[model samples]
Target: MAEHTAARPRGRPPRADREQVVHTALRLLGEVGLDALTMRRLADALGVQAGTLYGYFPTKRALLTAMAEAMMSGCQDAGENAATPREQVLALARGLRTALLAHRDGARVYAGTHAVGPNTLGFSDTLIGALRQAGVDAAAAVQTALLIVHFTTGHVLEEQAATGADPELLTEIDDLHQAIAQGEYPQLAETHKELTGTDFTQLYERGLQLLTSDVP
Candidate 1:
């Protein structure tokens, strides 16, 4: 009798890799938002077993970190043609904000992840170099860069959060306006327009200016 080899199992083929997993996860993030972008969901989207993802990203946080890094790609290039250190810093800040605003919940996706990937590192190095060139000390330059990043990320988080202006948020704004009009808070009443302003673009630019004003 002829020897017979066992047939290969008929099932879903393994098709996911690190890049495809991150790419699909990011797509799912945009589609369903971060909270709903689970490993099982990603695997299902990729037509693979949930355990397959662990081979590419050991944990959810690892996957998120990779996604964050991918989102930050080419951000530092925005400062390439900047004329001054201040301009370079501002360019980088604006670039970061733009990057964070590119996807739904992008800021939340990047907020707490410690991504040491090339793109993130390049952005940090370029920002710090600009700060140092503007006469800031080594430690202070690093700290200032962190402050700028924190401010940019935090501002983008609020900006993204306010994108739809839900009913509850509108009600809260109305309540604040009424409360300020009561005269119990004189200062708030005096600056009520600024307090209730919805011009995020203006606010973001002003904030960037203030953050970089002392640079040079």
Candidate 2:
């Protein structure tokens, strides 16, 4: 061993490039919240050195933007699918739910980020196109998609927040049921099961049916 040489840093130097690095960084953002995602962590996740990540994402804000874009890409892919507009709308709702559920704190990550990514806009195009194909008027069709997205996101937020299906809410319902059985609330007691029980999945599907049923 003669002369000791230092190992050179890996990855490209910072250039005015965007797409590839943005996409990779966004994937990590979708997995972990922006605050939790660090350059070193991204490098570890990407199997590259921290230096390489810096070349792509100069700062955390830049990285956050990339994540927002990645999350919306699903709509882009959905638009290309052969399914009908109604099906596509429902698919997007389910897809949003799936994506939010995929990573920890997903909904929060997307909550205030104003990312109008192509993938998201693509899904909107598909939803509107399919809705038009199905005879839903332009305005209503747009509103319908917005409603679905809003509800889906809100539902996911609650889903992730609950420790276990919201025990307090369930306990309150139980109290109501007890009051009903004691004849303090006869009509409510008569329909206690119906009131106290819910199948959110079926409810979500039913909501979709009610919303998109304008097609005939």
- lDDT on C-alpha atoms for all candidate structures: 0.90, 0.67
For all predicted structures, in order, the TM-scores are 0.90, 0.60
What is the alpha-carbon RMSD of candidate 2 to the true structure?
A: 5.8
User: TM-score winner among the candidates?
Assistant: 1
How far off is residue 74 in model 1, in Å? Answer: 0.6
Q: Write the per-residue lDDT of candidate 2 for residues 27-99, one digit (tens) a residue.
A: 7655665566787876776666677767766876666656655766665455447467666666767777777
> Model 2, stretches more than 4 Å misplaced?
1-65, 79-83, 163-199
Q: Whole-model lDDT, candidate 2? A: 0.67
Most accurate candidate by lDDT: 1
**Where's the lowest-lDDT run of ten residues in candidate 2?**
13-22
